[model samples]
Target: MRNIKIVIEYDGTKYKGWQRLGDSDNTVQHKIETVLSKMAGENIEITASGRTDAGVHATNQVANFRIDAEMPTHKMRSYCYEYLPDDIVVKTVEEVDLNFHARYNAKVKKYVYNICNNKAHNVFNRKYEYHIPQPLNVEKMRKAAGYLIGEHDFQSFTTLKTKKKSTVRNIYTINIVNEDGNVEISIQGNGFMKNMVRLIVGTLVEVGLGERPADGINDILDKKERKYSGHIAPAKGLFLEEVNY
Candidate 1:
C-alpha cells in the first residue's frame, strides 16, 4: 500500500464542514472520499490535519490516505480534481511514508479571521469576511492579543462542552493587521479546542470595539472562565490557513 498526502484548498461556504457527518453528505471529507473510492474501486478514508467548523474555509488543508492501487500520485490528484466540486481543489499530491499521519504529525496550525470594519459591507467578499459596522481600534486589539501569545489554559476561549481532558494550548503568535477596511487576525498555535479561535477573535473584537478593556484578555486568562470572554465569532470569517509539520 502506498500512502498519499494531498494539499487542498476549499471554500467552505457551501458545505457543512470538512469532516464527514454520518447523517449528512454535504461535507468536504465525504465528497473527497466518495470520489477517491470511485477511482480506486475500494473504500478510501482520508485523515485531515484538523476539522474546520461549518462555513469555515481552508487554504492549504492537508490530508493523507492509503490505497492499494498502483496509480501514480499525480494521476490520483487529477482524478480527485476531475470529480470533486469546483469549490474544492486538490492542489498537490505526493507519496509519503506509510506511517505519516496528518493530524498527529502537525506541529503548528495557523488560522486567520477576516473582518470588514467599514460602515458598509464589501459585496465582493460578503460570504468570506465578517462585517462589523462598529469602528475598531486595531491598536487596542493588538495589545490584547499579546496576552494570548503564551501557553495557558484556554478553557475560557473554547466550548464548555468539549470532551477533551485538557484545555491547555500554546499560542505561538497572534497578529492583528489592518489594510483598507479589512482587518485580519492571524493566530498560530500548537493545538486548539473547539471554537477556541473564534472565541479568541470575539474577545479581541470586544476590546477593539471598546466594549472591553485592552487588558481584558489577561483577566480572562487569569479567571479561566468562559463567561468573561466575548461571544464566539461567526464561523464564516475563520479560515484554516496553514498546517506546519
Candidate 2:
C-alpha cells in the first residue's frame, strides 16, 4: 500500500464540514472519499489535517489516505478532480512515505478571517466574508489582538460546547490587515479549540467598536470565562489558509 497526500480547496457554503458523518448527507471528506473509493475500486478512508467548523472554507486543506493501487502522484489530481464535485477541488496529490500522517504530522496551521466593513454588503462576497456595517477601529483591534499572541489557556475564546479536554494552545501570530473596506485577520497557531478563532475575532470587534477596551483582552484571558467574551463570529468568515508539517 502507498500513502497518498491530497491538497484540497473548497467553497464550504453547501457542505456540512470536513469530517464524514454517518447521518450527514454531504461533507467534503465524504465526497472525496467516495470518488477515491470508486477510482481505486475498494473502500478508502481519508483523513484531514483538521476538522473545520460548518460553513468554514479552506484554500489548502490537506488529507492522506492509503491505496493499494500503484498510480503516479502527478496523475492523481486529474483523476480525483474528474470525479469530485465543483464545490471541492483536489488541487494536487503526492505519494509519500507510509509513515506521513496528515493530522499527526501537522506542525502549524494558519487561518484567515475576512471582514467586509462597508455600509452595503457585496452580494458577490456575502458567502465568503462577514459583513459588519459599523466602522471598526483597526488600530484598536490590532492592539487587542496582540494580547492573544502567546501560550495561554484559551478557555474564554472557545465555545462552551467544546468537549476538548485541553484549552491551552500556543498562538504564534495574530495579524490584522486593512485594505480598502476589507479587514483580514490571520492567525497562526499550533492548534485551536472549537470556535476559538471566531470568538477571538468577536472580542476584537468589540474592542474595535469601543465596547471593550484594548487592554480588556488581558482581563478576559485571566478570567477564563466564556460568557465574558464576545459572541462567536460567523463561520463563513473563517478560512483554513494552510497546514505546515
Candidate 3:
C-alpha cells in the first residue's frame, strides 16, 4: 500500500462538515472517498488533519489515504478535481512515506475567524464572514487573547461533554488584526477541541464590545465551565487556514 497525501480547499458552505456520519453521505470525506474508491476499485478511507464544523471554510486542509494501486499521484489529483463537488478542490496530491499519518503527524493547526465589524456587510464575503454592526475595541480583544497564549486546560471554552478526554491544549499564538472594518482572529494551536475556537472568539468579541472585561478571562479559565465562556460564534466565520506537519 502506498500512502498519498492531498491538500484540499473547499468553500464548505453546502456540506455537513468533513467527517462522514455513518450512512449519511452529506460530508466532504464521504464524497472524496467515494470518488477515490470508484477510481481505485476498492474502499478508500482518508484521515484528515482536523475535522471542521459545518459551513466553515478551509484554504488548506490536509488528508492522507493508503491505496494499493498503480495510479500516479497526478492522476489521482485529476480524478478528484473532476469528480468531487465544485465547492471542493484538491490543491495537490503526492505520494508520501508510509509513516505519514495526517492527523497524528500534524504539529500545528491554524484557524482564522473573520468578522465584518462595520455598518454594512461586504456582499461578496457575506457567506464567509460574520457581520457585527458595531464598533469593536480591538485592543481589548487583544488583551483578552493574551490570557490564552500558553498551555492550559480549556475546559471552559469547549462544548465537549465527554470527561474521559483531556481538555488541556497549548496555544502557540493568537493574533487579532483589523483593517478597514475587517477583523481577523488567527489562532495557532497544538490542537483544538470541539467548538473551542468559536467559543474563544465569542468570548473575545464580548470583550471587544465592552460587554465583558478583558481581565475576566482569568476567571473563565479558573472556573473551567462552559457557561463561564461566551457564546459559540457562528460557523460561517471560521476557517481552517493551515495545518503544519
Order of quality (TM-score): 3, 1, 2
Give the alpha carbon lDDT tens digit for every residue of 87-166 in model 3. 99999999999999999999999999999999999999999998999999999999999999999999999998989999
- Evaluate model 2: give its TM-score: 0.96
Q: How far is candidate 2 from the true structure (C-alpha RMSD, Å)?
A: 1.4
Can you write out model 1's per-residue Cα lDDT over 12-126, one digit (the tens) per residue? 9989899845688899999999999999999999999998878999999999999999998889888988999999999999999999999999999999999999999999999
In model 3, which range of ten residues has the least summed lDDT? 19-28
TM-score for all models, in order of appearance:
0.97, 0.96, 0.98
Q: Which candidate gets the maximum lDDT versus the true structure?
A: 3
Model 3 residue 54 lDDT?
77
Q: Candidate 2, residues 166-185: lDDT per residue as tens digits?
A: 88899999999999879999
For all candidates in order, the CA lDDT equals 0.92, 0.91, 0.94
In model 2, pairs of residues that clash are none
Which order, best to worst by lDDT?
A: 3, 1, 2
TM-score of candidate 1 to 2 decimals: 0.97
